[model samples]
Target: MFLERYHSIQDNKVLISARQGSLFAKEVAGDFNPIHNPDERRFCVPGDLLFALLVAHFGLSRKMTFHFRSLLGDSVPLTFREDDDGMIRVYDDRDKVYIEVEREGESTRDQSIIEHLIRSYVAESGKNFPHTLKPLMESQGVMFNPDRPMIMYQSMNLSLTTLDAPEPELELGQATLVPDGKRGNVTLDYRLMSRGKEAGLVSKKLVVSGLRDYDPNTMDAVVEQFYRLKEKAWD
Candidate 1:
């Protein structure tokens, strides 16, 4: 799932945060583990770290592997590793399901459910979306910029100018955001989305403007909100 990690372990400590996945982990399976919760012991250290690492490695292999209270009462331990060709392979303790990362250079013409959903969210959002076709949409640290959250927005195309407004507000270091896929050519949305549904769409308006004519106060508020709710799409 999104909360898995890939460790290049030598002794015990993580050699590097090689793969940091920050996405939603599913408990779709029957036997979801208690440790997956935020309050579980060392939850922050192990759970988040592991998930981030898995995402960095797995990309989008399975549907975030959710196993909540298996058909039988059993705890399923998560497993991860790389194959000879450097593919990510994962298995639940029960071994009922398995996910193997596609070869690195393969095209995503055939993507998983989650990958499809993510693509859908970006595609419907409007014109000039990334479609993420070129050099790959993902990267380290640069995936987000508090000042310009939409830089990585999987737009369908790119434009000389794109803008959004209504100046939504969010807590410091964050903001509420939604995918707004229905809104043609959107950089961001003021509304928040229901994470329960992986990909929600919205229709709204965006405007292009000059930096000098822009108000820092409004931008600051919207930027903060963007940071807070970005993960949810509307945050």
Candidate 2:
């Protein structure tokens, strides 16, 4: 229900306007990536928004994996399809796929449970930049290009031991970055906590391109600029 304003369905096709996507990125997920800015030339909907929409529409499965195939631009008319085997695909009218999902095991359509998980996951995800990735990059002696930071959501997997928790929260666990030359793969592991007990786990994979030798001074400026943008947006 919270996602209603972020997207629209007409003629069985979904359309997400740039403003809608931007609001969801900043207001909901707390992600201030420039690419999600409405006026940016490279504006695109946040991948986490799409992930949240899937769970909201199809319910939360015990095991689910989302593989992002392409960047979804604003106002794209997309369609969703689910196969008998529990594979879901989100694609544009051109038939170009943006995300593919595979789900298994039990599921729940409980709105409270879904909303809680969505909020908790995105809140933790919004901290990936300075909180998680910065230290990981520093330890690995690498950092994304300062001028043109290119970090993309590649895929994410979710596994739940049960679907009984109505207000489960996500806590960040171990995070790792594996670098291969100019490209780096980032994996963020998270735990689902219900009433102080572990309920399940989730992992998000990201691809960072144009990585170069880490420079503390350069990175510091980048981080500062990021916070500045966030402040300006809220102002």
| Candidate 1 clash figure, as a count | 51
Each model's TM-score, in the order given? 0.21, 0.96
Q: Model 2 segments beyond 4 Å from truth?
A: none
Candidate achieving the largest lDDT: 2
- Runs in model 1 deviating more than 4 A are 1-53, 57-75, 105-235
TM-score of model number 2: 0.96
Per-residue lDDT of 9 in model 1: 45
Q: How do the residues 49-71 of candidate 1 rate in per-residue lDDT, one tens digit apiece?
A: 33234444444332233111111
Who wins the TM-score comparison?
2
What lDDT tens digits, residue by residue, belong to model 2 across residues 131-187?
899999999999998978878999999999999875678888888999999999999
User: What TM-score quantifies how close candidate 1 is to the native fold?
Assistant: 0.21
